[model samples]
Target: MSNSGTPPRRLSTGGQPPIKFLLHYVVEQVPSRNGRTPCFTAWLREELASGQITTWNDEPIRVEDTRPEFAIQVYDTTTPPSQDSGGDVDQRLQALAKALHAETRGEREGPPGRDRDRIDVWGLPLSADLSDEERIATCKAHLLAEIAARDGGETEFPIERIGNSFTFGRALYIIDRPPSRWDEGEGGILELLWDVNPGYRAMMVHEFGEKYETYEYEPIVTRVTRAELGNQWLMMRHGASR
Candidate 1:
């Protein structure tokens, strides 16, 4: 399975840069060569589950995505192996995802990311006496920062909402705070519904009992306190119609 740790650890070569590698996973549809031995998909998993992850110089490989027939994984043997920390961190998996990324055939990368997933977290500890507009400004500054992030965070693209589908990048959040529902100086919360479109390309995979095509319509939930929203909002800067 996948080994993304709690709060999902961020993997960038900050300090004591660890050895990095890439695991290209893809299970294509191909016929057996001899029509004899069982397909690698059947028994290959057994071996992987049995503590056999790699084959490159005996590199142990683990398959987690839907398909498990054919996978193309990669690694960089350039950097020397870092010291093991009592086996808590699997160097092998680390090698695969320490800084794992993807470079599709025709898609252009955003900045420092495209081949990987990036989370944008903003922390603000402003003065308590700031006005609501000032707080909104703080939130806006944070949103702008996130939009300009080198990795995959918020994008400059507008967040267009039509009925149920919201454009991938958020536009702006319309705050509807009920005045009678809260006391003065008391912080409130904003709940946003984000309909995420992974991309335009179509990926074929197995579903139910047959092959079904599905687009990435993953809806994610995010909570922002009035204190955290700062003075600004997460709305797109320009071209944000509706």
Candidate 2:
């Protein structure tokens, strides 16, 4: 729960390019009668099969906070992907980041007074350590795990890579077709963009529509940490079936 007036800070992408992958996650506060106990925490406990996590961003992941009822932090990998691999590193990272963003926070539009789920997305620099092949493989592995979790062990709808674009060696674009249940259309598309120079920039665009209806697009901005990112990936990997 970020303050309405103060926007959460975006991660700085300038100095010390990412050498490791980190995932940051945030969940809206779940209400309870007795008191507020973050449901996200309970969900994480079930997925990890252990309630104990020692650190996040070099500090404890669990800390007291008045705002943002639920949060998670984790890392995808401490070492970079192998280099001998031939693949688009930026595209793969962008796809994972966009997918994570969509999973945690999707588009929502409804009348007033209606309760809805909210989540945020944070973009960090792609780790320079992993090789192109490694990055692509890592992204595919994570996506497969997520698809399995979402499809209840039935992966009828496989993750699809639409395409990607690179701009003047500074900007990167990635598109993905993820699983969906809309009877009117095939599935949803996630688009991600990243720029390195003149300060790092990241953006996400989600598009979906019914068969006869015009497509709907939503843009998002918010960031999470490595640990939180990891938590989301794990939840998608382990919690969806439960």
Model 1 ranges with Cα > 4 A deviation: 1-50, 53-118, 149-168, 171-188, 191-242
Model 2 segments beyond 4 Å from truth? 6-128, 152-242
Instruction: List, residue by residue over 100-138, the lDDT tens digit for candidate 2.
Output: 444443222112311122222222223656554454444
TM-score of each: 0.24, 0.21
lDDT of 1 by residue, 1-242 (tens): 23322121123434633333333332121122233211111101111222322433344333332332212121111222244342322333333222222212112122342222211112223444655555555555454443344245432222122222223343223232322332234334333333332321122222242232445544333434434332223221111222
lDDT of 1: 0.29
RMSD, each candidate, Å?
Answer: 21.2, 20.1
lDDT of each: 0.29, 0.28
